[model samples]
Target: MKQFCSIAEILELYEQYGNEFYSEEITQTSHALQCATLAQESGATDELVVAALLHDVGHLIDLAQHGSDTTAFESDAKHESIGAQSLAKLFSSGVTAPIALHVDAKRWLCATNLLYHDSLSRASAASLILQGGPMTSDEQLRFRSHPQSGFAVKLRNWDDNGKALEPPELNFKKFAPVLERVCLK
Candidate 1:
């Protein structure tokens, strides 16, 4: 529901609320930075790096819309959809599509990889139940057919691995150029 007009505005959103705890161990900003760092370190395209950075932005938007209640996480806030739709206003599908599908990628992984479910953090696993457990056969087929699904899977791996307690050396501002480059303008 938030209209992001520029990369600065999006950055400001992170600056404003990103310090909030994402899980017991990491803040939202730290998680984002770590994810983006992983993407960048792996030589992902700028769009994918930016997507990695901003994937959970919907949680911030939901926090703003709901006024600090924990209820957003209590149910399926659909943060992936919320973030992708909002980012789509200012970014191309290359950036937003991976974000949108990342959640489904998680579900798909859980369905396809027996060991994948064990890799999730407790918070992520709890959220997974709220996100409808794992994908059904039909859902997995649909997820596989999506063009962005592969990127989503990669992003999901980064998402899962990004929850480190140590803050990343690179901060959110470091990704500004990447975000600007991937902007729809």
Candidate 2:
């Protein structure tokens, strides 16, 4: 697993890979900044905000090696889990759990709410099938019961909304301090 030794290293990683095109119109950095901004605007805790910022870090790592292979996005690379594991050393579950579960939360929302599934963008809607489509009733139950599911849902919503907005002027430096403050170390 990749481990960031300092906030600067994470920022450097963002500098290096944040501009990659995500699923649709947004770049990876744009999506992350937008998600973090949304989380902060929604009164999320610092850890949750950091989680929002770093939630897609795995994609940075993955795409570095994989080079935007269609097969990658077409299949479930488990980016959520990959990101959570990579950041687990510096952050608590408050941060990592949401990073781990945002995709599952999307699945949960799809199974439980027709409006939500309908709200999905063309790319997101397409990726849904690859990301395991909707959850079963049993899966939804488990998701609801999970300790961090609420926050994960919040992040998931931001995740969807983030892709639609224009990228902001804010960059990794603006977020580095928040991440540093929330780190377990």
Candidate 3:
């Protein structure tokens, strides 16, 4: 089995996977940068920001493993879960929790909040009800009870707005220091 990848290794994996999977849209580096910026601006911790930066990483593996054009959103086989699980093995719980719980948070909101359901992607719309069925009695309690619910809420917002743009200062090497600093601590 593959060993737990280091932070730099993870970053490299992200770069390679991103180039392969998102070549049509924004680059993986750009996506991670945007996510990190959003997380930082929103007052997330360093680790959480890192997690946000790598949230969609599972998509890389998903494309390779599932050989599909789109993610299977109607089932529990979500990229977020896959990404979260993958990240958890390498990072701390605080970082992985937001990544892992984001999809569930989206599902939770869709079930309970009428407005949330309409805004989901096509695949998400199909699986909204079955993945705990529109915030049932148990779901409602679970949603509220989750410790990362608030962080998940923020993460969702960032995920929605983390669209790529031409970065103002493409300091490709800037984040390297931050990553090193955090990892070495």
Candidate 4:
């Protein structure tokens, strides 16, 4: 796992790769800021809000190594896992677990809610298949058993809808305090 010693280094990582597009519509920064804004507006806790802001940091991290390419997107880069494990060094499960399970949340939704799959964007739809299509009945049961599953689903919703192009109300710099408060030494 990548260890982050300070919020500044994380911010620098964002600066370095945040401009890359996640798909046709959203750049990495836009996805992140939008997700964080959604969490804040929905009255999520400080941990969850920070989790939202940094959920896709792994994508940025991965892109830094490989540059933007379809292979990067197509591979099971397991970005959620990367982000979560890296963050686990600095945060509790309240934050890290949700990030880790967010991909599963999407799978859970696809299994339980038939209509949900229709709502995914083109890129998301493609990624969904790469993410294992949907959960099995057994998978659903085990997934729901996790305490953070609901929160992961919530974050997944934001992650799905967060690919908007408009300027966000709060940018990366605005989340610095929250990052500091939750960041472990």
Which portions of model 3 show Cα errors greater than 4 Å?
Answer: 1-3, 20-29, 64-76, 121-133, 164-173
Evaluate model 3: give its TM-score: 0.75
| Each model's lDDT | 0.88, 0.86, 0.66, 0.85
Over 5-103, each residue of candidate 3 has an lDDT whose tens digit, in order, gives 666666566555555523345665676677778888878788777777777777766755655466544345566777877765566777778887777
Candidate 2 positional error at 156, Å: 0.7
Error of 3 at 168 (Å): 5.1
Candidate 1 C-alpha lDDT tens digits along 76-167: 99999999998877888999999999999999999999899888888888899999999999999999999999999999999999987876
**Candidates 2 and 3 compared by lDDT, better number:** 2
- TM-scores for all candidates: the values are 0.96, 0.94, 0.75, 0.95
lDDT per residue for candidate 2 within 1-185, as digits (tens), equals: 77766777778878988888886677888889999998999998999899999999988988776777643477778889888988888889999999999999999999989999999988778878989999999998899899999999999988988875566687767887898799877
Select the stronger candidate by lDDT from 1 and 2: 1
User: Worst 10-residue stretch by lDDT in candidate 3?
Assistant: 15-24
- Candidate with best lDDT: 1
Model 1 TM-score is 0.96
Q: Report how far off residue 19 is in candidate 4 (Å).
A: 0.4
**Of candidates 3 and 1, the better by TM-score:** 1
Collision pairs in model 4: none
Q: For model 4, give the 10-residue run with minimal summed lDDT.
A: 64-73
Candidate 2's C-alpha lDDT? Answer: 0.86
Task: Give per-residue lDDT, candidate 4, residue 11.
Answer: 93
